[model samples]
Target: MLRPGSTTAPSTPLIAPLAAPRTARPRRPGLKAAALAGLLALPLLLPATSRAQETTAADASQPTAPAADAGGGETRTEVAEAKTAEARAAIAAAQEEDANDPLEGMNRAIFWFNEGVDTVLLRPAAKVYRTVVPDFAQTGIRNVLWNLRSPLTLANKLLQGDWDGASVATERFLINSTIGLGGLIDVAGDHGLTYEYESFDQTLAVWGVPEGFYLVLPFLGSSTLRDAVGFGVEAYGDPVSRYLSNTHDDWASYTRAGVYAVDLRAQYLDVLDDMKRNSVDYYATMRSLYRQRQNNYIRNGKVDPDQFPSIPDYDSK
Candidate 1:
């Protein structure tokens, strides 16, 4: 198949040498690149390293941790143990009453101020009220006040989708207000219908709000961020408050509040006194009790008696 004068050899693809694949050297990270990567990762690593160091320091600083054997397994000297003890003591002394309370300093200050007010004015007034008020009359006032809270409870129940609770609250309110003579008696309870009280705070808790932090409010003792917000809701939504405001009876609101505070204080006087007497640290004790009870209430769980180690003895304040 060649032309007579053609000089070109027939190209034989079959016997031709195949070109070798170019071997590529794997490019390693350069020193500068590795350094840059390390630099970038340092922030992420630093926190962990810092935490690790702190933990190690804490461990190293402890007297409880057994020292490595020195030749014949002699432990750390007594001086070392003493130093550790001193450090621990210092830490304990310096630590806040409730580490969980982020606003501990502010809370304690407010608590002291509240205590001053109570000691000066409220306590004496509450004592006088308790002394002068007839027992039956006090009971009646309590009943009426409790009854007034029905609307709040009912609304919260409805919000929480507790139809049965809302229904019960409604029946209780109607029966007590009418049959019990303006909630001065316990007709509802006598008929085996009792309260299923729920606050707007509890409703918020039911709706999956996290308790942000412990707070000791000015007059209101135990609260959290969520509870504070809930309190604002309750304040605005209070039917009695709204009614009084509409009727231009603002004085009634003040009177109602004053009576309520005095009554509550009187009721808790013995309980609080006993708590103060028995507690090594009143602030800490109150914090524990408040958090424990509130948490139980929020979850609709019965409080574990064991959780309250130092129950200085009071029922249902």
Candidate 2:
């Protein structure tokens, strides 16, 4: 009820508002204490959570560590395999070299004997010849010697079925013997008909003959069994040798052979010296070179440049 003179409103509403009855919520001391404790420990718990996350991250990266280790292991395995292959190759090369030089002891003895002869007699003679002979005279002598061997080269070319080479050799011989005045000048070479040396050994090689074992002749620096046989045939069948033999002038034939040897040696002085200077095993080096040269000859000088030794240009010098 409101008094007419009262300035204050009534404490209770005139009509109760339409609403559901409110339930009282009870206070729990234990739940309040637990919440307060959790709040108090929050700082420490945060660090522990971060530590756990770091541990999980490290565990995730662990698999990749093993992958890296496996990669390293593979690299090591490859290196080991490469080393093994190299060792095997070295052993195989050694065995092959040994097989090629079966008569090493005897060959070395003969090689030393040849070396001795070269050192004592041939080398000095070659030096003297080079000093005394003019370059033009040397060229003339070389031409003459090559011309003398033209017939033999032609025969070998024919035997090897090289018709073109035989024809060139015949033309060179005819031109040089007459126009060049017994081959004192290379008129055929001036006309672009270059001389090509051929041997019975090369012919035999073309015919599929094996070179046989490496041999060191008493006078010859290096040879094979096949080449030694070829040399004997050449000596017996040489036109000049035959003519001299028939004329009963054995001394003249010897003189010719001696001069040929000296001239050949003189031409290769620098080349041989370079080889001897650089070689670890002179005999083995010579053997390898001889085989390479013989192979080159058999192939008619058609070989890889890398496979050939550094032979000096006699004409250029």
The residue-level lDDT of candidate 1 at 92 comes to: 60
Top-TM-score structure, candidate number: 2
Candidate 1 accuracy as TM-score: 0.65
lDDT (10s digit) by residue, model 2, range 1-317: 67899988778656555583445334567988999999999998999999999999999977778789999999988877776677677666664754477888999999999999999999999999999999999999999989988989999999999999999999999999999999999999999999887999988888999888888888877888899999999999988889999999999889888999999999999999999999999887888778877878888788755443333222311
Q: Locate the minimum summed-lDDT window of 10 residues in model 2.
A: 308-317
lDDT score at residue 301, model 1, on the 0-100 scale? 77
lDDT (tens digit, per residue) of candidate 1 on 99-138: 4677889999988888888889898998999999998999
lDDT of 2: 0.86
RMSD of 2: 16.7
Query: Ten-residue segment with the worst summed lDDT in candidate 1?
Result: 308-317
